[model samples]
Target: MPEATADRTVRIRLVDRTGRQVTDAEVTWDRLIRMRAEEHLPGHTARLAAVSGAGSATRP
Candidate 1:
């Protein structure tokens, strides 16, 4: 990134299945990206499952 764009904050939090505030853990970009991608798979599947084709839009 450019020097001017150095100011950035990636706030992240972890939690269990129950509503509990889990904290104080370390993570990396690769791990975070993979986790996020896996999370979106189910969401995307449900959103586009009823579409007619692969190029269909799930949202208006």
Candidate 2:
């Protein structure tokens, strides 16, 4: 049997203090795009999100 690959889709949500969805900073946006495109691994995605202050990455 072939080995199965993990799903790389990560849902990222950014909201301001007013509870309104907002765009991420350049750094965060770059990371987000890369993550969403599956360019980064799950661990890397979570770390990037934390460092960029974008949000948390959870497994579902």
Candidate 3:
């Protein structure tokens, strides 16, 4: 879940890598959209790399 912040952006709480402290990170609407796509891109790319197609495939 996300909390609405005063900055007009949705804020999500994240724990530090060390797992000691918590922090608030603000994500704008545009960034949230990009983030959603970006989050899946790597997994999609990995799957594509692992799968060899019978036909030719070209990357942009």
Candidate 4:
């Protein structure tokens, strides 16, 4: 039987005060993107989302 490969995806939500979605800083964005799209890190995807002072998490 052929080997099977599995992929993992991570999603995060960031929140700010007053219940409003906010954008991440450039540095943070780069880090998050790298974690998801690294050459050595295959079969995995990472996504980041910012919410109103509340963070969300996703598991794969």
Number of the top lDDT candidate: 3
Q: Distance from true position, residue 42, model 3, in Å?
A: 3.1
Q: Would you list the rank order by TM-score, best first?
A: 3, 1, 2, 4
lDDT of 4: 0.43
All predictions: root-mean-square deviation over Cα?
7.5, 13.5, 7.7, 14.7
Error of 1 at 52 (Å): 17
TM-score of 1: 0.34
Regions of candidate 1 where Cα sits further than 4 Å from its true position: 1-11, 16-19, 40-60
Worst 10 residues of 4 by lDDT: 1-10
| lDDT, candidate 2, 1-60, per-residue tens | 112223333346667569998754434444566655785467677877788778445533
lDDT of 1 by residue, 9-41 (tens): 345686655968675455555555656778756
Compared with the true structure, the alpha-carbon lDDT of candidate 1 equals 0.59
Better of 2 and 3 by lDDT: 3
Off-target runs (Cα >4 Å) in candidate 4 are 1-27, 39-41, 44-60
Query: Of the candidates numbered 3 and 4, which has the greater TM-score value?
Result: 3
The window of 10 residues in a row where model 1 has the poorest summed lDDT is 1-10
- Cα lDDT for residue 8, candidate 2: 38
The local lDDT score (0 to 100) that residue 15 gets in candidate 4 is 50
Q: Of the candidates shown, which would achieve the greatest TM-score relative to the real structure? A: 3
